[model samples]
Target: MRHAHTVEQVRAAEAELAGQPLMDRAVAGLAATCARLLRERRGRVYGSRVLVLAGSGDNGGDALFAGAALARRGAAVSAVLLSPEKAHRAALAALRATGGQVTTDQNVGLADFARADLILDGIVGIGGRSGLRPAAAPYATAPRTGLLVAVDLPSGVDADTGEVAGAALRADLTVTFGTHKPGLLIDPGAGHAGPVQLVPIGLRPPAAPVQALQHADLAALLPRPGAESDKYRRGVLGVRAGSERYPGAAQLVVAGALHGGAGAVRYLGRPGAEVVRRHPEVLLGDGRVQAWVVGPGSGEATVEALDATLAAEVPVLVDADGLTELARRGPGALAGRTAPTLLTPHTGEAARLLGGAATAERCAAARLRTARELADRYGATVLLKGSTTVVARPDGTARVNPTGTSWLATAGSGDVLAGLAGALLAAGLDPFDAASAAAYLHGLAGRLAAAGGNRLPFGSVHSTVGDRGEAPVTARQVAAALPAAWRNATAPQGGSQQDAAGLGD
Candidate 1:
């Protein structure tokens, strides 16, 4: 698993290492990475133009020290100090000793920024909550050909929540120190931080609040049937989705459930005939099931379905119309329930569940916060689906799905996800594990389907949009690709375990 620590946690860890040369370690890693990139781009670091956008604080100090290193190696390095008065005194002195040029002039900085072979952004650090200040605002829209590398994280993004309030620098790569920050792993901020490189500085943090599961992690969590396993022993999933108005929802949900390692799926809704036609393997009329999937396209019957499903002492997954009904009834409806409850909601649905003073647009901007709130308010595991899907438990611990694609925005996708998650719950995984695992598989399936069934590498970092060479995919195609995704995820790692961890070069 890839762990993401908050700024406070990182600070605490740094405190433990009090007198160590943490800055030196960070500067060495930063300069080395810059040197490698320079060689790759222009054949050598000597005589190459490098620009450092230095602000106040250690973030800027790291950049300045790195600039000094490059200068010693014969690179033409220049520093643009956004805050000259507050810049790190020792770092500035080091840069001057190496003959690196420093200026407080904005126009000169813009000119250097335009022509440099490489740009290191240290205008803001992880603690920056607002957008770029006036002196550095112009760089946000500046046109440049060279690669822009963020020192620790892109400026103006919340370290804890991944929220981008306004203008922020977009980096081609980010060299983060010690550990990955929560902002770099989530959307909005993640979108700005292109690819990340971890540079350890020996700061040991406690338990991470946010985590992303990799291939080995998923492989360990996946439920495999033993030799003595039967249909009943493997686990049966109960599906209460679809209605007369929307029969296709039923077919898609059942399709996803069948491939979720569940032995059998019990269909119980108005669209039973349609579901049976698409999947004759699905048992008609539920008798006994380990878990229940409610909602999807059950328009008018949502109330009845949710009531009946909740009455049973089994793990229940609520989605689509079921989420709407749950929102209407309030969190109190779920009171006194012993079994785990999983709620999957897109941003809009999540906003509704939150009720007072919440809007879809606001929730989208603060995905981590919104998910935690929903999980706490509903007293269940909440999976907030978006460009980055976040699964949060009532205890505030959360996991972000790293495999999501914009191609999954198609209709009926959520229904499919609901079925898959419900099936995993039936297979005996807790709500948190079931939701996280299902999201991982579902996202991988979407990617596979979008790429015309071509098997992509497991745990590869995916953009908000689909990966390169991918085409649009329908919900049915996504469901069809689940088996392929499952196989790839469970495949033996051999020597490619590092690639399976999603650590980029």
Candidate 2:
């Protein structure tokens, strides 16, 4: 799994490494990465034009030192000091000694930047708040055909929250020191960062609040049946979804549940005929179940079904219409439940559940905070779905899903996701793990369905549909790809033997 540390956590690690020249080590790594980028972008670094937009902090010092290294290696390097008076003296002198050009003129810098093959953005750092300063704004605003590489992180992004307040310099590549920042992994800020390269300076932080699951992690958590396992032993999931008006929801939900590894699905709703017609494997009525999935096109019958599910003393996954009913009844309604509860809500549903100050806009803007607040308020795990799905537990810990694609915003997608999560709940995963794992797998399924291939992790050599040229996906296609997505998730970390050895056609 990939972990992201907040700014405060990074500072604590930096404090531990105070005796070491962390800055020098970071600069050396940065210089090496820049050199490699230059070689890849062009043919070589010897004759390439490099420009360092240096500010007045440690970030600028790192950039200047890197520029000096490149200049010594015969690359024509130039440093435009945003704060010339306050720029690191030693770094400036070293660059000058290596025959690197230094200037404070914005016009000259812009001209050089426009013609340069590579630009190192040290105009701002992780500690910086808001957007680019007036002097540095022009560089960010300028048209760029050359590759832009950021030192540490892309400027103008929230290092802790991943929110971009204003104009930010988007980088083609970012070489971050010590550990990965939260901004580099989350969206908005993640969108600004192209491919990130971690330069380890031997700094270790505490356990991260946010993490992204990988293949091996999912494989370890997934439930599998043994020789002694029967249908009931594997687990039966009860799905209370759909209505007379929306029978399609029932079929979709059952599809997700069956493919999600539930031994059997007991569906209870007015649309039983339509569900059975589509999936004969689903049982028409519920007698006993390991877990229950409530709401998703439930119409007016949601309150009754939710109450029945709540009284069972088993895990329950509440979504869509059920979220509205839960909101109307408030936290008091769920207070009696001894079993785990998972609440899945889109921004609008989350806003309604939160009420008053928590508008849909606010929930979308501050997703992490909203999910945590909802989880605390209802004493349940909150899986807030959006461009970035955040799964937050009642204890305030959260996991951010990075596997999703924009094409997942389709009709009945949430119904499929809800059913899949309920199956995981029945299979014995905790509310937190079930919700997080479901989101992770659902996202991968969506990407695979839409792209018609495996969607590799970020920064991998394999490209997305946009690069390969594919079309959009429907909800059914996403459900159909569930097994493939599961296999990909459960695959060995080193990759398949056929793929690695190129033994397959």
Scored by TM-score, the top model is 1
Q: Model 1 reaches what TM-score against the true structure?
A: 0.97
By summed lDDT, the worst window of 10 consecutive residues in model 1 runs over 494-503
Candidate 1, residues 303-403, lDDT tens digits: the string is 99999999999999999999999999999999979899999999999999999989999999999999999999989999999988999999999999887
Give the clash count for each candidate.
Answer: 0, 0
lDDT tens digits by residue: candidate 2, 232-261: 887899999999888788778889888888
* lDDT of model 2 at position 186: 64
What TM-score does structure 2 among the candidates reach? 0.92
